[model samples]
Target: MAPGGPELLLIVGIAVLLFGAQKIPALARSIGESAGQFKKGQAQVEQELEEIKPDASGAGSAGAGTDAETDLES
Candidate 1:
């Protein structure tokens, strides 16, 4: 289902042909930054979901607003 080594190499070769070797590093860096931003957003959403759910004792959601404010302030 996933690409093997040769397929990966072929993909890289195509990328090189399209973008050229000199631009590859910049493209990779941009992709890396985008991926990082995506991950951070995903983590924030998960944390918010956790805050919204009641605890084991069913005490109800707590501190969700304050946490948002903290994130905004930082």
Candidate 2:
């Protein structure tokens, strides 16, 4: 009566056998910390984007003003 993937059940059985139930809580806490760190990094990147000032031309397009003739003549 396996409801989901067999791989997950197999891994869980192995973990319970090797580490027992006592160590699982500590392992889960460590995983939670890793997940929190990932989320914090994602938030910092989004905050940096919001803090950035848009260019004066207002289109927010880089390499917009370069002219081929001016560049070639120089």
Candidate 3:
């Protein structure tokens, strides 16, 4: 469920009281920066996963050389 107007206002008021007016802007800025970094990291991980997905699906079809190689090594 989502918060209503009153609940949001109450939370904002509490934050203001806890952090003070002067610090609020700085806190907001830091929170925004952190969110941006989190999103960037999430995108990077998704891209890497996409890059590996095709290779993973084709691995089995690449043939039995892998097994033969392992046997030779032993």
TM-score of each: 0.70, 0.56, 0.77
1-74: candidate 3 lDDT, tens digit per residue: 98899999999999999999999999999999999999999999999999999899787756677888889999
lDDT of each: 0.89, 0.81, 0.93
Clashing residue pairs in candidate 3 are none
List RMSD in Å for every model shown: 13.2, 7.1, 7.5
RMSD of 2: 7.1
Q: Which model scores highest in lDDT?
A: 3
Candidate 1 vs candidate 3: the TM-score winner is 3
**Of candidates 3 and 2, the better by lDDT:** 3
- Model 3, runs deviating above 4 Å: 61-74
Q: Decide which is better by lDDT, 1 or 3.
A: 3
**Model 1, span 2-73: residue lDDT tens:** 999999999999999999999999999999999999999999999988876656435423466667888999
**Model 1 spans with C-alpha error above 4 angstroms:** 55-74
Q: Which is the winner by lDDT between candidate 1 and candidate 2?
A: 1
